[model samples]
Target: MHDHGSLPALGWSEFLTTWSLQPGWLLAVVILGAGYLTLRNAAGPASTVKGWRVASFLTGLGLMYVVVASAINGYAMALAWMHMVLHLTLIMVVPALLVLGHPLTVIAETGPRAERAMRSLPVTILVHPATGTLLYSLVIIGTHLSGFMDSMAQSTPLMVGEQVAYVVSGFLFLTGTIGEEKVRPDLPYLGRIALLVVGMVPDTIVGIVMLQTERDLYPVYSGARPEWALDAVRDIQTAGGLMWAGGDGGMMLLAIGLVIAVVSSPERRTKMTGRFLDGVRSARLAEESARGTTEGPAEPGSVDPDSDEALDAYNAMLARMNQQH
Candidate 1:
């Protein structure tokens, strides 16, 4: 007969077990988290285009990433490279991209009595550079420590702690990436640049260590492999490689994206589209004043660049104000 409980260790405690499924708590968290987020959104004023996009991503992608993966793998995924890959993708990629979509702010600030909570100190602190950096580092190092991952995988409590770590770390990292209100305006550009670089340090170290190792570090996996696949050492090393090579690359991408975002602000972008309009306005104003064309058509429909208006009204006003006189 097959020995079900007699399997060998697949390095369950070596951390980086992206295959570790978190079914029960993860499901409850998703259901409740989504509901809470939805209620918060409802408390805000009117919904916005951005808000809709955020909601769509969270409901469609986020829920799937959390529920399905957690349900399938639980804590037994340390041995599965494929599942690890999925876990990392879900933890970092989804969170970062979803944050880039800016769903929370869209739902919170643009909706009705939009909660000021998002802008509150507690929220801001959660997304601050310090917080993101700490969360990212600890979630990686603390969880992966041989003792922690092994011990935790063995019990329900530690397993749940793992869940909390991943979720909170992910949330913080993404929020830091996408938030402007949580901006570290006081931080010099170079400082922000260095912060990101520093954040990648642990991941780089972990990946390098894994790649260099010849054997599996985690003794937690109690299962055997197909032999053609990775042995313990190779798997552990590959986990490192995945972090350093892949994670470092991700950090670089985020840096590039940030630079692009800064340079591509609407105000900065407006130079291209608004330049001709402004120049034409200046020329016409000079011409009309010289010609005494009755104080320039009263400019009654002129839309203030600083004011908010319906798209229709704004477009209509802009068209009228730029009339030849």
Candidate 2:
């Protein structure tokens, strides 16, 4: 057997070279540090710290794995195709699992006002139906049909832009799609299902690209396939097809779990739904309040006729769940 130690050290840009201070690795360290802080913060003396610890650790691993491929292959070598693959894991796979580690609920407990704001504004913009639909379509088409994927491995600047787009879009999709309670007041199980179905469109395209492409489009990496004598176009197409078919298929399965969550998670699910409704209430209230539609500040003790009893009940239910939990 060849002595593994005899292998000469490779430079940073040289494929399969010794590990070095590459940008992707540096990016990974930052991600790991952030997740570490997230877990560490959530683990404060009393709570079930195991969840955050595990979540943060896994998130770190997921990020590192994505970056590792880039680091070894050379950042900007192929305009960033590797980074796209990395993002597939970062935004889609990792966040879905990491949220279960408990940092999200801890974030919920950050008090009503702050939590409200964080989940509002920028967060709300993304969580909305229009934005989710837009993002899902873009993730599907932007990454594939638009020819953006090929350059991500070639240019660092474009790669950064791609990453920025992917992270923002993915995170928004996840939070709005997953732990939407803090942002939205009331989301039904079916509604979430609809959104996830939208999200899967991108993956479906990815798979189709792989399955349908007649010839390899990216010759660089596919040409370098380690052992497999795979055709470049066919290989790229297969990757897209796998992304389309398997990725979305996996997302659908995850959606099933989310359905269970909406059905079973009383504290988390109800409050989230209620809060979204509360936002609707607040918006309407602002509208009415602005137009002075109520005639006058009602006589002290006078009940307003427009007050919604269901809203009151929903609010009460949410309060009780919070206190009880």
Candidate 3:
């Protein structure tokens, strides 16, 4: 039964006018924006922060508010697809933009003590690419697969928690993968690509489950949906389709961007090639060790395999192999 008092059908005009104040979210955005601005200004004229990065951070903060306080949030209860949009934006788009802004780098710029803290052990572990990737995958799979979404509908705090989880997981994942955050070592381009690819598995699984399931998975949404809303089954299917395509598509674009970065930058290209050669070198060394060769291990503080001399040696070895072949 449609509640006549429920929100009117979500036409374009209604969407434009249908925003809620969502005081809590709005306040959070204000505080974060103000804090970022204060920090940026305090970083002083000598600080090397770029204007675009500052803008990106502020834009992400603004988008966080818009996502939770806008008509999309209002319609999410009725529209599974809208919820997925919210989910993806929180986990992927917003976090990526925020990472690009390099907020942690900004914080580190304040002082040597802050820089030291940012690069401390605990912080390093927290932002490690592997850690972030695992957390992102778990959060993606767990929330959608478990009873959390259904429970979220009945509890305001759960709903907020869900939103928070999405943003935090995304931020952590992207911080490790994308930005020059002082908290962690820079992940290799190949490592970043792998992390993103692994992250897509949960998205694909959740999307497929939602899309293909004939059973109505989310009763709360089905029950609460206004008459104008899509039927329960269709809503989920739509949401699933969005999740599958949007999730994979967004990640693919990011992967392509990473590939482009590697291709365009001499340093990145050399690093990538060197990493591959290093793996091969390690395998050969292990083999020789197993065979009881007299060769010793590399010394401490060895030159990076990505160096020009290393590249020339690797290429020469490859050319020799080709000639032998």
Candidate 4:
């Protein structure tokens, strides 16, 4: 462990050395690099894979280094607020970037065997939305429990486990909700928006409770104070603020991206229009049924151009008529 005295002036050498000692960071770098190289080498003339996907994957790996192998991790062990930042990065930023890279899709495209493996029953169940959501919620709630947090702080292995859990849960949540990977049927843009909105509730509640609490929830930080001079109570409060503001801020950004995606997609626009027309037709049918009356068909060659429903129903009819003529 780096000395607490030099934390205020920690240098790059110390940061690199400390991070290199951790097996997790080394393992992550190897896996990420290997995956990217494999994908690149496997690409053929017909491959549609682009450069941005590789960049995104590398960016995720960099984020992992920052969270676990940098000076930030050193400070996190001694400060509640820093730990919260680490947690937020692991559970939100890193996973979002990885999912956006479409790693699973890339792997599947590599070969038939890989595609088959991705579609196996166990993989299917693991990537389901319900499973992802439940696992994510469990990790968020479980790690925050008083006993668990303190115990994690005391044991290196447990702390590493907690970090791993955050990454896995975050990946699962995004994969199940908004990722391009075909785990189950893809969620429509509206469904993605709704899932993200509802997911914010638990994080918001946890943050608010942390902020309101009078006592320090994690005692491990009390003993090893950072050189920058943050008290335990203040540290806890700062952590709460990070979780509240940072977590929500990340979610809001993702929501904005989803909105952009929806608006830009021609297919989604067409689907929405069809759904709107179907809904209108269904309501009209139900109203007619309730009134115990049936409307006569329109005159074969006429359209009520002034009526909104008539216009909607016949808008494409004009195009067909023009083509026929």
Candidate 3 lDDT over residue span 225-261, tens digit each: 7888888889899999999999999999988988988
Give the range of the ten consecutive residues with the poorest summed lDDT in model 1: 1-10
Residue-level lDDT of model 1, residues 2-81, one tens digit each, is 11243234454523343445466567647755764665466455544355545545653555455345423432344435
Candidate 1: which stretches are off by over 4 Å? 1-26, 29-52, 59-80, 101-107, 110-116, 181-192, 222-229, 266-325
Candidate 4 weakest lDDT stretch, 10 residues: 284-293
Tell me, by lDDT, which candidate is best: 3
Expressed as tens digits, the lDDT of each residue in 1-325 for candidate 4 is 2234346644577556555456767787788878766875685554455678677877887788777877677777777777888999999889888887777777777788987988888988888777877888788767774568777766778888988999999998888666866434566567667777767776787788778878878765455665565767787788888888988788888888877776898655433334446466545433433332266544332432234655555555566569999
Each prediction's Cα RMSD?
10.6, 11.2, 4.5, 7.2
Arranged by TM-score, best first: 3, 4, 1, 2
Q: Which candidate gets the maximum TM-score versus the true structure?
A: 3
lDDT of 2 at 46: 45
Please give the lDDT score at residue 306 for candidate 2. 38
Error of 3 at 254 (Å): 1.1
Query: Each prediction's Cα lDDT score?
Result: 0.56, 0.55, 0.81, 0.72
TM-score against truth, every candidate: 0.62, 0.60, 0.86, 0.79
TM-score, candidate 4, is: 0.79
Off by over 4 Å in 2: 1-87, 98-113, 180-183, 219-229, 262-325
lDDT of 2 by residue, 260-325 (tens): 776687654544344456466555444433333456432322332235743554456577679999
Candidate with better lDDT, 3 vs 4: 3
